[model samples]
Target: MPVGLSMRLISLLIVFLLLLPSTEMKRPGKGKGLKGARQNLAPGRVRVAGRHSRSRSSRLVRLPNCSESTESGEVFVDCQDQRLTSIPASQMWLKEPKHLLLARNRIRVLNDMAFRGYESLTSLDLQQNQISLVEEGAFQGLTSLTTLLLQHNRLVTLSEEALIPMPSLRYLRLYDNPWNCFCPLDSLIRTIQVPSNRKLGNHARCAEPITLKGIKLKQVDPELLCKESDPTGDPMEDQRDSTNTLKPSPIRSKPDAIAACHTYFFPQMRMDCRKQGLTEVPTGIPEDIVHIDLSHNSISHLKARDFQGARSLRTLNISNNNMEHIDTGSLAGLLHLRELDLSDNSLLFIQYGVLEDLYFLSQLNLGGNPWMCNYSIHYMVYWLRLHPAVRHSGLLCHSPLEHNGESVEEYVNSYNRECPKDRQHSQIDQDTDPELWQTVMEVQREVEEELEPSHLKAPQKYQIIRLS
Candidate 1:
């Protein structure tokens, strides 16, 4: 009896173990479902870098966040504003891409053999990047490339060997960089200055050796650049690595003004760059901008043609800044300007011809400034006198103890009585209205004749009259 019972118990235990294994297999696995949920591998959605243990094949697909599109039967890979550190050509370039745009990235160097397989590419945009070094063989395999944009970088010069590979290249942009204007830049400058390369380096200018600063590469004489050695010695600038062919200058290439500043289309086409700490006015402002607020900055001077492109601007606020001087013709293009603010600045006076371009200006704010009521201040007052319709204020004296705390108008009146200026100056000279002055003189003569001839001569009195 004991043997039979023990044998039956062992048979029941084997059956129970087999049933448990089959039951677990038939039921759904929770871990597998959660893994798929975390990846979210849905179709038509863009994928980002993931923390999952990737396969060897997937590691080669670490491309920038891009959205593919087709135009004119050509494939375009736009990776703008991706915060990318390197070009996507070597990592995940398409087979037959015609355009590979990587604008506004953080790419700082272009090593040799960079775009090895990009032979079919026609246009490559590298503008608005922080690229400092571009080795000689960087464009080795780009035989079909036509357009290359390198504006807004930190390149002091470019080697001519880099251009030898790109024979089919036609359009190039190298503006907005701090060009060193030294011996190494001679070959590149001479190449681009040729009439055949008209569109190559249009607006690129030198930034070092103060004499050559602000001079365009096209206008510079290539023969003279290398003719003189380091006459000025090494430039007093940030020291760079000695191994580089061309020194990487300080990054002064300004970003796109429309992108750096805030733009609003509704109500009015305006750009608000208030408190941006801009030392100089940025270029490439949209031509359609109507109002611009550049107040609360560190701009100490306004260069000539600063507002050259903003022809449609109506209101300009440059108040609350360190503006001490505005070059002649600085505001040369604002033909439609209606209002301007110069309040709360370090200006002692306004120079002549600075406001000559604002033909239709109506309101001008000059408050909160320390205007010195000197002879140089006459141009501003004369301009206001001619444009009587312009509503303006803040013309007060802040120096010359005798004229301090007095309105500029009162000081002008006193100065005219004491030390008069010429009539052509638009000053309120008595000679402007000859009839009025002649009548006063005749009345005084008649009074003198009646008093002195009849009895004792009484002293004639004349009152100083003020005119605008």
Candidate 2:
């Protein structure tokens, strides 16, 4: 066709030939043997890369002084009471230990990755230490950890981030620490109170902010804790953590019924709630509880059915309180009660039927109370006479113009002498129980005073009995 056109086509063909080699080189898996082997080697390289982490973990510093032993084909490191100031190098264990006991040590602060390389730890005991601060991710690499004992430490607050590493955690002892009961403690308290975490945080109590002092961690109302944190407050500063990465998860609200008390099964079932600053009788006493000590409190009144759930209760100590009134049926269903201590109180007189449920009660302590020596005090005397086998003390009169400082028994005799036999028989026949409806003793006293000046007898329907 044309000599110039042929030469242009040949030059284009040469450029195309040069581009062909570049294109071929970019094709994936182009070589049948060498490239295919490289593809096969890729997976091995990835597996080797994955193993590098384990190798690095193994290269950690060693603790040559750590005591080691074998149990059930698993390694155990017992460094408890070693007076350790900090956690030793975790790579001391060739194989991750099953149990690591660092209890009763002097370890104070647990930083992030504190227990790294202890991936197989099932139980870790750090109890009775001075550890007050736990940074987030402090328990990293403890994936199989189950039982963690942090009790008797100085931990005031712990982030949920520290707990996230131990998914298998079950039993956790966090008692005896001075836990600051405030908004900062919400997440940790909630984690300890989950229904599945029943054995966790048993007997842990607050040690600060007077109002919540001595209150159990489980019973301290979370809503009360969230009482509008000051906007000006730096929560991170309040948490006392420099690296505060905790994003507060949704806290759940639960209805708590367990009393803020310490329960014991050894020797015998007992509930001790002394000096707890209680305003009233605590609810939810366990039915199987045999003894309960509630002295040294601020309980001003005992409501009816307060101890109804404690059917098996044999002994109760409620002295050293502000109790002034014992409502009817307060002691109901206490058929097995054998001992009761009601001393050191503000009680003037116990109402009728208040102690009728203690069929087996053999010991009664009513000392240290301001016992009134009036007609309203007759029920207490009558009960004591009927329960002749009961050993009791502190029945002296504390009031009334003539009966002041006299024995309660003497006041009862004077009352019986003044009460007319005919009128007493008639009243007893008319009323099934003298205090059947439990009229207020103060009302009866007021009626007696109102009737005396006019010398008018009480109406037949009224239950006022005047001493002639």
Highest TM-score model number: 2
Q: How many clashing pairs in candidate 2? A: 0
Model 1 Cα shift for residue 124 (angstroms): 0.9
Compute the lDDT of residue 140 as modeled in candidate 1.
94
Candidate 1 RMSD to the correct structure: 14.3
Cα deviation in Å at residue 311, candidate 2?
Answer: 3.2
lDDT of 2 at 236: 28
391-446: candidate 1 lDDT, tens digit per residue: 99787888777888898877765765564223323443656588776666566555
What overall lDDT, based on C-alpha atoms, would model 2 receive against the true structure?
0.75
- Model 1 TM-score relative to the real fold: 0.43
**C-alpha TM-scores of all predictions:** 0.43, 0.45
Which sections of candidate 1 miss by over 4 Å? 1-60, 90-95, 229-468
Worst ten in a row by lDDT for model 2: 43-52
